[model samples]
Target: MLWDHRRRPHAFAGIRLQEFDAKAGRLVGPQKTIYHGTDLALVEGPHLYKRGEWYYLLTAEGGTGYDHAVTLARSRDIWGPFETHPQKHILTSKDHPLAALQRAGHGDIVDTPDGKTYLVHLTGRPTTQHRRCVLGRETAIQEAYWGDDDWLYVKNGPVPSLRVEVPGTRDDTQYWAEQRYTFDAALHHDFQWLRTPDTDRIFNVAGGKLVLTGRESIGSWFEQALVARRQAHFSLDAETVIDFSPSDERQFAGLTAYYCRYNFFYLTVSGTETGKRELLLMRSEASHPHGNLEMPFDEPVQLPDQGKVKLALTIRGKELQFYYAMEGQELTQIGKVYDASIISDECGGHANHGSFTGAFIGMAASDCNGAEAKARFDCFVYRPVQHYTDRYEV
Candidate 1:
């Protein structure tokens, strides 16, 4: 439910069901209000379930924080007089600090052909003591059963388990490998392009290369060119080979671990007014409002003559390192390790603006002179720590 303006007693003027209308190419036709929470302020993420002659309405409530929970309501008709469950909350992670997953809510019920039901929902894992969620929100599944009173109950009663049993008929042998995007096809759905409103087109892919047209610098609140993907793990290896000739001293293109519009780290290929091209590694923080601090490098190094350079960033624990490599050569460390927490939700301040969006690592290109320079990426490779355990068994 959303509102454009205030309407006296009620927060919103109209209450409508959320649905997609493919014919109109947009979310339209709420049809009618089937259900709402007793505390409407905290109600969202609703899912409909049908059993026997009853239509069950499941909703996530109490905000998307430690107080989050899954509650239910039911009615005989599809659209009226829905009654909240006596239990109020069917699942939650409140008070379960020791549990592997916390802040659990937004559940969806999936029924198998064998009559078994399961609840799949969003959950988070905070660090051991800091209570900072480095892995961000993740999906978890829990088995469900119907009681004699016709109420649905999770197998372990509420807090999700670290070890979940899988169905006997489910496959247990498949495994996943590292992700490598050659840009041989479409950009992976996980990748995102960052830009400001009314920005010009600056991204394209053709001839097996992902090209980005340079615009304003990364710090620009107006039009800028950047493409990135989420940083899903504390330990990960991300690399990309970029090809961009610096026609002017103000042009730069490289890799970055972006947290928000104000916080990030960059390892870019740039040139000086004197025409000396080099790779620069730097970290930007909101606390240091003046400008970014340049990372120390081991020795003097310059960009390759061909303008094709491989840029890599690795995150292990709280340390982040940058590297560079030429064709057919080993990757050489470009600078000393730097703190990786700046690009995190817990850093700078509370959730506001872009901080709540999570961290991302990808390519960035900028031409401060508005020269419309372009940068081409050969490929992007990402290798995250893979967990092999029954807890992630889906």
Candidate 2:
């Protein structure tokens, strides 16, 4: 069942179960609507669990503010006419000693095979001067149980630390294998392109490339052509071969880390005066012009006869390295390392707080007049690194 909080009048605040046919492997029935309205403001992190005769729908709410909390609602049927806790804010900051000074919310509930329930949530770090809050939100785990009234409760307040046993690790070699995604028409619906996307730009699906006709160069204020997916601390590699002979010499196309219009890092191929290819990294701000970090390759790696060349970016922690591959081999290491810290609040940069959201990887092409450029993305793969395993129990 998928919940849509963007319902009209904000009345449909609960769950909506879409019936599906196992044989056909597709949705089958008219969707059944459950929870609704102010009761589920910005409600997310929904996990359904069945025990005995009861089916529970656990969710997080409170608008990503200091008052954010985790709550519960249950029903006997899967498509629930569910009932919430008599008292809201079941698993909240009030229960933690450190919560009063900071804030914690957006929690996910995980139950063990042994029947132990745990809550994992994001919290702001505490410091002497509260003015400086790093965007790096930390995740902590705690033990939880139901009260007499059927309300969920966590041990300790604000910052609970339940000494629960960590689960055994799985054989990750089989799990870490690369999975391939073939570009299909059905992907338009299955994949979430963005949380909040600019409606003005049109994504040319037929052209096999996302074309951005918008004037904003990803660093603009009103509308920037940016699309990303959830971040999970994984290593990703993608190549886009582009043909840019349509315009005179003022066209560009490549990969970027887009936070917003005023903040992002991009590596692109621009037309030089002599009609040669030049690789450059552009960073911009609302108050200043684009900052270009010229990354000159040994020679101008020309796009194939198709007028398209492949570009790739590899992310490893605070370092995002760029590369260009022609044929099947990497041509030159585009000597540009974008310090992820610059766009991260943790390293003292002016950017939004990175809460539950992860970084997104995608391609972009823009600023061409008659010279129609087409970008063909050969492949995109995300593989988890060993470092993440060292940091978290996952």
Candidate 3:
């Protein structure tokens, strides 16, 4: 089952799960949201199940504030305007003794082969200043059993530990990794990511490797001209070899970590006044208020006679390292190790609020005086540590 959060019309909403035919690999139908609109806040969790002739849909209600709860809806058919309990709020802050003080929401439900059900929901950790959060929400398990009316409920309310047997077999611990995609094939904007993308600054997908033309410098508030996916906790290394001829001293082309319009890190190569390639690092914060800092290369890196160079970025946790290679040899490190946490929400800052997708690695080129600079990315690669025991199993 898949659960999605809908946020439209100025209020928190509910979750929706689609039921599909496993064999045909197509969506047969979907289970609609049981509780919706401002009444439920944001219903983010939806786990579906079939018990005898009845179908149960479990979800979390209330906002991410202090009054979140787990609720249930039931229907005879997989798809329905489900019937919510008259009491409405099933699990809430009042339900748990260990809830501390903040809200609890965004849960996952899992069922074992032995017909046991458990709910895994996220809860906030309180701090002195306020309820500042990382992705540090903890998961709690609750014992669930079918009631007299054929609905499911936690046995003794929201306990810290449900004490239910783990549903699946044990496996060795594995680390999560980032998945990288190259726009080498037909270029289309239909690909799925963690969030919707800005369409104006990104283009070109015909041959291989996506070509992004930078519109403004990295410090611009609304027109950086870079498109990227969101970066989660997983570490990633993105490398792309770009070929571009600098028409003027102001032309630049390279790779960047684009969090949003105002928060981004870029390592680019531009033509110098003296006709040499200069590698530089530029960054911005808070809608580009501080302008940009340029760390210049000690010596200009010579590009291929065709004026092409390869740029790459390696991101591990909160650090982003940049490197440039010419003729297949690492020639320069563009800048000091960038502390990525500074621009992330975890660091108590906001720049790229609307760009919540995963970290993206693509090429960008920019020119002055309306002169178009074409960059060809020979290849792009992303390598991440292995994190899944059986990726296909899920």
Candidate 4:
């Protein structure tokens, strides 16, 4: 069984449960609607597990926000009218507003050999007061208890905890918070071209630099020379060194906080009408159809004559600060801080468009003048203030 959404009445509307059967080596069945959440506006992340003679259906209800939660239903048959849990929500962060983790739900259960049960779920740790989760959703584990009535419950009061006691050795030092891409030969595995653009045609890796050919503007959906990685943290510093001199205003390249082609915050470097090199900070607020607008976040500033320039973005809490530096000059702040939430999936109406992916910060190049401009990014570095890891006990 699976859950799918329809965007007719609204974005992320009518999340209906559907069933499919797998035979032999292939999945062969039509989507048959089994359940439609009557009380919830958005229901998703359905997982069915069989325990003994009863079949348990776990579902993630509500939008993926503070109200996100996990609900349970059970039945004897594989497909039938199941009974909802008496408590409604088996696990959630709604009741505990001040908890370290919020937006808790979408979980899976696993039992260890020693009869210990644990549930691994997604959760979000938001900033103080603002309630915006810059780290996005992350994995959290909680112990589970099976009662005599055959009902399962989260053991830790159904709320996400900052610390959970696990019966095993945990070495947090094994995880690294920094990721550096030298582009020595090819793009790193973490780097991916936005959308389904032809990677071989639009990008080339040689001479210890990743070269991106300008195709469409940053706001165009068809083809844009943009490569990005997920934010994955509330506080992080992303820096990229690029060697590009734009010949005209149409050709530009810079660091970008990209949600989509229409919804993005870009600090682009380009040439003015008088052939003077300048840096421009802009935001693209685009919706479906013709509801699109591009606004300048800061006035264009002239750049010093340098062979290579380093662009950096510092994201902390809800603000994003951009910086630039020449090859040897100290990094200088560019413009005022902009709202980092503008690049979030919630603000960009990702649910309305049925896109569940999170935000991405990356490098982009554009040449709307059809000049076939190229931008070379020598290296890219992403250093998170905190490291995240998942652990399991044998």
Candidate 5:
């Protein structure tokens, strides 16, 4: 808490107090150094709340990793010296690595009409043992109450509880309901494509089907025909029917379990150089340099002259498998079971907490031929399967 030039190690990593310019409709002016904590190291995300005579200053520190926590400070005056909480951190999962919800911090407090205090914070669910956050960070709430000493605290203290009761209604039926999209009139709300303002050049919805005009390769960071939704469950099923005719090996259109260019499993309806239609499986991992694709099947499955193929993927915890079916036949498992953990936060683009995004299930089309062939998808279904958080049988 000292203000000596020799005491601070880093530049521009502390919490500051700024003023809002009402006339300019923006925040302006010089910043004031109210709290520069060297003990907690990486301090950021400050929120101020006033209750009675105490001014509470909450900050998220410890680098948003396993050691992430919520540090609270308070003072009678708005600008003088603030004392840290008795326990320092008011909400955290740092010590409880095995907890169902992990990486708890960067939170805000709320009060309800029932006169109860609650804190909503960020959380994550990692796969067992490997500790990969497959779902990235999620939101969680905890019951809180004012302490006798005038400090705010989480209900049970630092470690966040698995479940907390809040003043709200939760409908399980509607929460876990299946969503089916036909793409009849226009693009559905759940679907999103790559970053590009010129969407009309990549995809369009016509004749009750979502059509993708093959553009850049699927590994493209910009302007790729990849439409997808967030993978939000630990166990789930995703199915889509696509009719794509790739003239050569340079073209591909089908389903993909994607994380980034370097981490994904794509099952596509591609063609050989001689123009023979077939099914191909491509795998890429973090270890692969330059984002190269690994063709798994020595002999790709030959497809019939008909065009429609149903592509699907099922994710159970850390395992992912792909399936395919013809027009009137049942779905059949096609490729080998993949380590779904690879398409997660830890294994996404870099190792050691570099990436912090979840996976996505989507349809993609790539054409290096410059022909802009069309790939039509009629329906997509997302069905979530509830399961125990722990690696155990229900």
Candidate 6:
């Protein structure tokens, strides 16, 4: 059974079950409402398990906010008049705002061959005063035990731990190493494009460059040529060299620190009315609804229309700055510092429950006109700065 949010008013997220016909590859029976979490609204992520004589129904509740939790109910029969857990919520980080791992819930239990039980759940790591999650939701595991009381509980009760005692070697080289990418037969596993599966329409790897054909606006619902990689560290540096020639302001190719359509800072190369190619800065603030757009620079910085331009970003905690360089010139700072914290969950979405994804920094190209201008990126580099504190050489 699963909760359906669409069945509102009459059945707000009603957990319903139906039989599936594997041969037909479809649901083949009449669905029936199995449970309604009246007390704890917005219940979802249901998992059913049986051990000995008891059948357990596990669920996530209280929305996907700071108050999210994992609840348990059980009965002897599959069709249950299930009794709720004594504590109701078996796991959560809701009450512990200061906890390193927060928004803990949506979990499932698994048993090892040696007879140990473990619970795997979703969690978030929030940073800054606004409690925004720049790295999005992460998975956490905790040891669990079936008690003499016939109830399952996370070890040390409910709150999630920062680290778990698990058998595995942490790959430090993969975690901290710098990534230098040049596209070939396939897009690197580290990078991903938004919305579409038809990649050839937007980008391709050829002539030792990742060529991005201009699409609609940066945040267009239809499509956009914006490819990005996740931001895993609190501080890091990103650089890319692009060769693009835009005929007008509408045709643009650049680098951006993006969270969502509502929050981002972009640095693009395009043409101005004075018939000159220049670097422009565009930022979208996390406003009430759509967002508020702003141009930081008083005047556009002109660039030669002939060669490759290197764009760079250095993000240290909440501070973000952009840098640029011409073919033979040294990289120099261009824009003022921005509040990089805005590229976080708190500011990424219009509503509290909407921001589930993390921040990203990447390359993009767009053209409002029908013309599909091409932006060829020579290379893209992601270098992690190893430091406990935000301070480090960039």
Instruction: Report the Cα lDDT for candidate 3.
Output: 0.56
What is the TM-score of each predicted model, taking all chains together?
0.79, 0.56, 0.58, 0.84, 0.92, 0.92
Candidate 4, superposed: residue stretches over 4 Å from native: 1-23, 26-38, 41-43, 174-176, 285-299, 304-306, 350-356, 386-394
The list of candidate 6 runs beyond 4 A from truth reads 1-11, 21-30, 390-394
Candidate 6 backbone collisions, by pair: none
State the C-alpha lDDT per candidate.
0.73, 0.52, 0.56, 0.74, 0.82, 0.83
- Which prediction has the highest lDDT against the true structure? 6
- Which residue pairs in candidate 4 collide? none
lDDT of 6 by residue, 44-127 (tens): 888888878888989988766788888898888767778889888889988888887788889999888888889999888787
Candidate 1: which pairs clash? none
Residue range 200-293, candidate 4, lDDT tens digits: 6578898999898887888786888899888876667999988888887888898998877667788877877766678877676544543256
Q: Give the RMSD in angstroms, all C-alphas superposed, for model 6.
A: 2.7
lDDT of 5 by residue, 1-394 (tens): 2234554475424667777989999988876777765376667778988889988888887766677788888888777478888998899888887887778888899999989999999877778688888777778899998889998889986899877887768657854789888887978888887787789998999999999999988777777888988888888899999998888999989999888887889999889898888999888887666566788876789998576999999988887889999988899998788888888877776544356678888898889898998899988888887776535223
lDDT of 1 by residue, 252-332 (tens): 889998876567798888776766778866567755654355555565467755757889988875678888988778998
Query: Which residue segments of model 1 deviate by more than 4 Å?
Result: 2-41, 76-80, 168-176, 184-190, 195-200, 206-208, 247-249, 285-307, 345-357, 386-394
Q: 38 in model 5: Cα distance from truth in Å?
A: 4.9
- lDDT score, candidate 3, position 299: 58
In model 1, the Cα lDDT at residue 329 comes to: 85
Tell me how far the alpha carbon of residue 235 in candidate 4 is from the true structure, in angstroms, after superposition.
Answer: 1.5
- TM-score of predicted model 3? 0.58
Span of 10 residues, lowest total lDDT, candidate 4: 385-394
Q: List the residue pairs that clash in candidate 5.
A: none
Q: Model 2 misses residue 206 by how many Å?
A: 3.8
Candidate 6 C-alpha error for residue 125, in Å: 0.2
Error of 5 at 169 (Å): 3.6
How far in Å is the alpha carbon of 159 misplaced in model 5?
0.8
